[model samples]
Target: MRIERLWIPEKPSVGKDIVQALIRTKRAKVLNAKSAATDGYFSLDTGDVVCPLFGHMLTMLPPAAYLTKEQNAGNYFEFLPLIPQPFKFEPKPDVDAKGKAHPPKRFNLIGELSKRAGQIVNACDIDREGQLIFDEMFLYWGLDPAGNRFLRAKITSKAETDLDRSVTALEKNGAEHWVRQRMAANARQVMDWLLGMNGSMAYQQLTGIKTMSVGRVQSPVLAMVVLRDLAIQTFKPQTYFVPVVTLADGTALRWEKRKDAAGTAGFDAAGRLIDKSLASGMVGAIKAGARGTVAVASTKVERESPPLPFSMGRLQATASKQHGLSVEQVTKAAQNLYEKHKAITYVGTDCEYLPSAMHADAGAVVAQLASVFPGKCAKADPGRKSRAFNDEKVDEHFAIIPTGLVPALSDAEYAERAVYETVVVRYLAQFYPAYEYEKTSLVVMYGPDEFRASARRDLVLGWRELEKPESTETEEAPANGPSRPLPKLEVGQQLAATGVSLETGQTKPPSRYDEASLMEDMISAYKFAKTERDRELLQETQGIGTSRTRGPILQNLLKRGFLLSTKKGKRHEITSTPFGKETIGRLPPWLTDVATTAKWELMLSAIALGEAEMQSVIESQIQYVKTVIERARMQVSPRQSAANEKGAGAAKKAA
Candidate 1:
């Protein structure tokens, strides 16, 4: 069953490894020098050709070079957007002012291969981004599938078994619907280009700044920082006192009040009383072992739902919160699992649910894990219909999970293994029994005051056997560790306090966002939208950026001085600088609004889903670009500039 040619990833190391696996799976033979060939590489026995491509050999043209002379003269772009019919693209090599390309030789090589191959296999990774990468090469060569036969070999992992399975399951696509993905990717790239190319030039010229970089996604992020820091600056600290009483067992209770007068900052979100005098007087009346009555006690057993599998955002948050790994670090770890170890599915997806159709494959994968995690494995019900495998929630690819190719962890890097294990535990947890716990509560009455104490005991470890929770905040921890199980309790029983104290504290400013929380905010950014309809638009659009690009955007913001990070102990605190704030202050709502970009992004997504035509989305953006140009042209008045100059002149005379 040997094919005439086999195409795979372009990296020599990866290509060589994949070729070896294909040889085993199909007994394919190599005909070339086995040396990487530019145009003539072939499979010897069957006359098949194997080729790999680095992604997107051709890209949208850059600003100065992209526009024609008349357009560059600021005539066309100033009034109208440059809408290339079919949207032109060129090789993304270093370009001179005249648009000359100095591309890597491989770009031309792929173009040549596109012309020769009769049966061109789209053996790219199984994601829209991957489809765009390989499809763009053929598109740039003007080689339509109408003339050449096309096949798609899509798989989420480089693992041998998954790769072999994909080889057999290849789909024939003479219609080139796979290239529809290229439409979505290109629309996004062009959308960014339109915003950046026009917005940056307009801003730099208007503000008299030598250089300014603005973006559809980047500008909104800048505003997030600016608004947060402004709130921090203007926030007034409120003073409050919390009543604390120590019990006979050295356990302390913080007085909890559900409600108070509306004007009182009563019991902050963490439930601390706002009345200082009342708290102080209550504390004064109490001694170390003050007698009180336990008015009521209750206990119940409940089962907690298993966690959904890891999406990039959840994984980033988990790693950051549990292990102090930065979002960048966690991303690299996930990449390692996909690329080097080949232990997991694709890592760049935002979807956290599996396709229901993959139940058999998931079951097979879990069966392989029995030896590795025997205790938890015994509890797994891989074939069960659960929340993790819901087709309605799936898009492009399923959640990141083990691909059944277990790696030797003894030789793996610590960070890589940590991320891999995190994914594995999360994946397995979905199939295991639900975690059951007994929660008990007791309330003590002191005159009119009441204090509640609660304790929880694991009745059944269940999925918790593999997925243990990490405590980050005090509120997240068991009521003061409840270090001991609650002693047998009875209603109306007398209880005593050993000591009492009044602790006065000031409300702290909202802390700067770290990567994990930032990722959460970016995903849930619809919460920041100005209107209900805009919020729904953002929610449907998956917020401001894709999983693959958001982290890099934040890193770029830090590099460009739009945001600053300071290490406080193990965790970093991030905030915006003065320049970042000023930039946001001067920008118009269209540029800085998250909902604005989200509205446009939703249209791009609709284009991808084929719900809306690409032309309409492009036309809408064109109108937005016109507004940007107008804003850039309308600068502050000359009289205001001259008045400032005159004031400076007067100040100098006085000096």
Candidate 2:
């Protein structure tokens, strides 16, 4: 039987060493090596009577030439030239059937090999996209689909040991789930194409906007940003009075802030603070000599589970909040660590927890990471298992862990090493014990006014040791610092008013969104969705976008002027631009709300799992699109309406 290998030049440059090792293990000899161009098709003959074919390069057509007139006359709907044009894939004559036919132009090796080979083995990277590439080649060859075989091979590092293991696995058996995953991946691509090509073109024609890009993901993401901006714009600030009283111990305490039965902040119909006079009167009475008594004193042993390991989004949020790194910067650094340094698995994942099986390897990964981050890694305990190691919480991939490739040299490298070290340390922390603490709550009442003080004593540092050094930098005295030791007291114990005063403060408006806070809000928005069914749906679907794509989605919104960032030192506050506000105002109300996308994602997930029908989803989406189009047409165009133009200008000024 003959065998063939198809390759792309770009792949070899990045992956040749691993490919060579695979071929060597197969005991295949190189019969010939050929290329169309230096950077084009670089194929190797496996000399086992196999034909070789070029990958992606073979299918690429030369750039089509268009005259100025033709370019101007081209339909506005024809936005993406890369998309298959009408009648482009129609069959063409090639010679006769008995080896008289001309060689296939695209991935010709597939056809050549199929003629002699009894079976075909697909050896591609064990990823969804990789599987798609192999499948495309298989179909292109017109070979018997049933005759094709699938092999899963992974190159963990450049080390021969890792390569050998991969080859051994390939020779034994391949993973079937990967094939199903590939089918899902292909479906996603097809769905995106259909939605983007049709919806985007239709929207663009109606809006008469050049280069209006939209997609299943991108459109919803854009709408989210626009909606957030509108929320900020439409927000009306109101004054709320809080009673602040100085206790006997000179400790100032603020009121516990009342909430409605539904747990909403107590406010009037117009969202103004309710019972303003009652709060002010309480503060005055407390200041006017009222002996304070210990109303309640309760201490509880609270064990805080160690934080889950670092997913890309979690890591990015942490880095943004703690290290002041931008989401883009953190993601780029992580990609380098994963792809170039080979120090970590896939950079983006939703799972912040690891399975018990991964715990055994945590020590080795921590040891490797310790070389770069001695301070943080030194505090990590390897043997213990914390809540972060819950296997039940892990999905798709485990928490980001090092691939055991020790990085060396350079200042930039050290910076990336620090980031990777953070990820590794967090990963290791999952196996460490939970941080145990004693939380004490003391409430002192002076007349009708109640003042509260809380203190926490760390009984066991556990995983918290990794954070101690950083926390130390921000530590301060009593009220601002670590909690003070409280004197023994029983309920109703009389306390002398050592100090009494009133502290007046103005109510602050809601803060603008930051990257980390935005991520939290996005997650919270889905979690707190109304209706049990909607909540359950969101719980199952998680959120509108995966952790892998959320950062990029946010970045795209910012790039598209839907979100604007205001920098204040290391902090970035996200706000909406006038264009963003206009977009939100013009968009259908349901489309602009995140809940809609959340629901759609839930349905899509259901469809993927075969719990929901694809036809139903398609029908719903079609109706949604129709409604959006109708609403958009009825609304005064944002660009054309003088009122909207003025409103946008005003919003910009306000921003």
Candidate 3:
């Protein structure tokens, strides 16, 4: 008999859970008693089959796949550019020691099952990439997506409850929403391939280099580090002075000249006091025992809400910053938490907001988390929903949060423990009340200048009681020193200066980019946009690359020898290598322009939203690839010139 239903998930692990969930719910009975959970698909007595597809079983064909034998043998420069009218794809092949190619067994299995199943359900991830993964397989197997037999099961989490909900709420596979998203994802994959293949080949052919790698996002990311390194290398410092007075009560106050027509300015435009004589005079005037009056005093109460739960990028950045973990380490740990333990939601999501509906599940999730982190989850109030519970901001997946499944882990797994606790504590903070504090601002009138001071006092230890801020973070103190708590005083209260001094300092260059800072910058690349339109577009799109690709982009650069990562204490400082800088210098401006790539991202987003046509975007990228190839052909290789010079010198020496 034809199978009643066939479910295809993104991987074997997800398929195993789906089978278990169906069995536990009594929705289906297992048919194969001897098959291990990890090895084979689950056949059910109800004629339903559960199978899984390895991530991206198929990929775009290489240039050789399109070019004729003669054209392939010709110089890469002569062919100029290879733009396949309609790109073709095939299953990624594996070669054995005997050099025979074999298609992945999983890929063949899916093809075989699609013939027998009456309906094929795409139970892959809920994102664009996931759509593309399933769609590609469907196309390769000659299965029609628009047919009524195909469906989409949007699973957000692997938890049994979520899986059942998703299965029961399946939608048509060829709906406009799914089509548009798949189209957009396909555009990104093809464009990246076009640029990487043609652009890199052009450079290699012209420069006589054996290997060169470039991409739409990778090149621009390399430029960010190279340009930052250049700025630091070329920066010039200017010396300045900062004057401050210490009151008898040990409060430090910074000196500021009054902004009046009759008063002379004592500081530079950058807020540095460059007038050495003025600084010295102020120190002499406000000597020990000199008196001053409080010209102004005020205190205001402020409330700081708890931080939102971790988005994947935010979690990676925080883990890198706090625990000195690499992006790969944190990402791997997070994947294990989601896939192996089923303890967290999707880990590739960039959104930090949760569905309002999920707010009701907070109590159950917290109860489960309490089993592992009893003390940390003690005071959480699941009833209170913070701003993070806004439904409008949620997309394919919600922020990373506990799935109410207790993770089976030991203390020895430091990386996994660190990642899980970081996510759990962040989730718990949402249930706590806002932190409240009273900030006091004071201004004292000295002989010819004004001194300012501020201090903060805790009024309500709410969320802060759960987790204290990282000690590495601190406020910038005044030139004299840290400010002390202020006593209650009237505006006319008098104070004596117990000491005064001026400190000499110089301007410092911007700090180098580390993994954490670079990741943050990648997410906020809109700030570097050159045009208002591009900035607005980048804002809507949220960055050049998706959350899943940014970390790999950085790692790929390091692997390709384009960037260097050096250990500075616990942090790895990133710097561009000489070859990296040379690559950027030789590339056209548009290639390294972050704004341009952001604009591309905006285009892709439009395609995904059904606002733009995919063909138009792909055509534009084809033109861009052609232009890059032509430009590369026009340039002479420095290596070629050096080789010529060496040959001439050798000839002269022989004569």
Candidate 4:
């Protein structure tokens, strides 16, 4: 009898491991899913030749025209982007150490196996790139699309249980319309490739630099930092005085100046307090033991819901803040936890909610963890519906969480353990009760000025047993400083103003972007948009780069010397280099704007969803590039010349 096969996309040995894991969990019978490594290469006998494709079996290549242009351009490779495109793909190389081109063994093996197998079931990772990786090979290997079936494996973790579950729940006959995903990935890859190369060329041509590395996502991020730095550089510090009064109860409050006070006919646009004299006069009056009655004081109990579970972007930011790890570092640790430790589920997801189908299993995992941790989930009700398990929120992948496989990490790195613990705690805290607290605000009358005092009192430990708001998180009222529990105060209570003061301070420029803040900014870039539609598009798309791509993009930027990194205590501060600033300055707004890039990403998504055609998006993208270059050439040439002339004049003057 002919045996059936369930081929997957792991390396040869790794494929064997998957089969073994399946067998261990009794998800697959040991006799049927035996390992076969007789030829020094491994495969699984899962009633068939279940094998691994390693990674990508074929490599995507630029068009022949672009290749010719790139080869001939030599040192001036930047101009190669100016060429038109008809992207090409060729089989990736695979050979032993004898300097022999043995051809791709996996590709050939797949071809050989496809002939015997009735259906080609794609058991690769459930992602666009993963779809492309396997589909490209199958198509190239001459497998018919009708016969080729896709079974997307949603492997949350590499644990035996997860793989068993993922393989068991594998949707037959490509239920997700996964081929469209391949189309989307192809469009994205080609689009980014074209944009980066072309954008870099335009920058090099405009700035007279031989080389630059600008991209759809990268240039905008660089612009964000550089523009911020420019804002800091050009900002003229304005001296302002805030009149503050302290009560006899040691309650300090700032005097409210709704409109400008007397001696100021009009307010200064830059400075809040145009008349320091008025503030001085008020301070003198208060120092003479000014007595005032409480104006409006209020207290209310507030319930702060537990934070949404960790999306990849959120996880990256949290890890960067909590452990002082770089985004790339956090991403690597996360990948390891999912792939190696089998502790956490799909780490690349942007979603904070689990799929409705997985809620039962996820709740079971939580219950198991609760038993292990003891008392942490005391208030947690697994049966209770929560925000963590929302069907609408789950997209291609679910949130990162423990897969009920408690990782038996023997000697993991401190940072790795820290990241894993972070994910675990985040998941644990999701089940706990909402953190309850009481907030009190007191407003007192000191002449015409109203002084405000606010305090936060903890009402319940709640979910805070597992998670607490970061100390570094921005407060609603930073000027008031930290919060403390307040004593009882009535609205009509009389209070003595012990002293008054005028605090002199200069306005601060926006803080520099650290990995944490930068990640947040990148994720929330849509919030900065001028319009609602732009914001909506961005929110849906999750801003520029995807969860898997941002870390690598940042790494590429740092590697290419476009940005400089400096360590400030625990945080790594990212600053734009002179070249970076120049690149952003030289690019047109359409190219440098994050919203514009986000639109392109969003368009690709629309294509994937059948809302838009792929060819139309690509054509529009090509036209957009041409337009950007045409417009930028005009703006950049004059500026570059002016800068050069200015530099020459300065040299002459020095001489």
TM-scores of the models, in the given order? 0.79, 0.74, 0.86, 0.83
What is candidate 3's lDDT per residue for 1-655, written digit by digit as tens?
4778889999888888778877766567888757845545778887779988878889888888887665554457667688887888888876789999887777777788888999998988877888999998877777677579999988778787887777778899899999888999999999999999998877766665647666899989999999999999999887877677877677778766544513236666655567788778767877745688998888889898998888788888888877788888888999898988888888878788999999889999999889888987888999999999998887667899889887788877788888888888899999989999878878888865678888877788888987786543255343433245765668998988778888788989989998888887777789888878767767866677877888899899999889998878868789999999888887777778887887888899889888999999999999999999888766856775466456545655555
> What's the CA RMSD for each of the models?
6.5, 8.8, 5.3, 6.2
The TM-score of candidate 1 is 0.79
lDDT tens readout by residue for model 1, 264-359: 444555556687766776777776345678876888897877788988777877776566677788888888778777888878787789988778
The TM-score of candidate 2 is: 0.74
Tell me the number of clashing residue pairs for each predicted model: 12, 4, 0, 1
**Of the pair 1 and 4, which is ahead by TM-score?**
4
Q: What is the C-alpha lDDT profile of model 4 across 91-177, one tens digit per residue?
A: 777777897787776667666766666555566666677777777766675654424354556555676766766666765534546
- For all candidates in order, the CA lDDT equals 0.71, 0.56, 0.82, 0.70
Top candidate on lDDT is 3
lDDT of 3: 0.82
How do the residues 90-163 of candidate 2 rate in per-residue lDDT, one tens digit apiece? 12224576757564443444455446553344444444445555665555555423333434444333434445
Q: Which candidate number maximizes TM-score? A: 3
Query: Better model by lDDT, 1 or 4?
Result: 1
* Model 3 residue 417 lDDT score: 85
For model 4 the local lDDT of residue 545 reads: 80
Q: Which of the predicted structures, 1 or 2, would earn the higher lDDT when compared with the native? A: 1
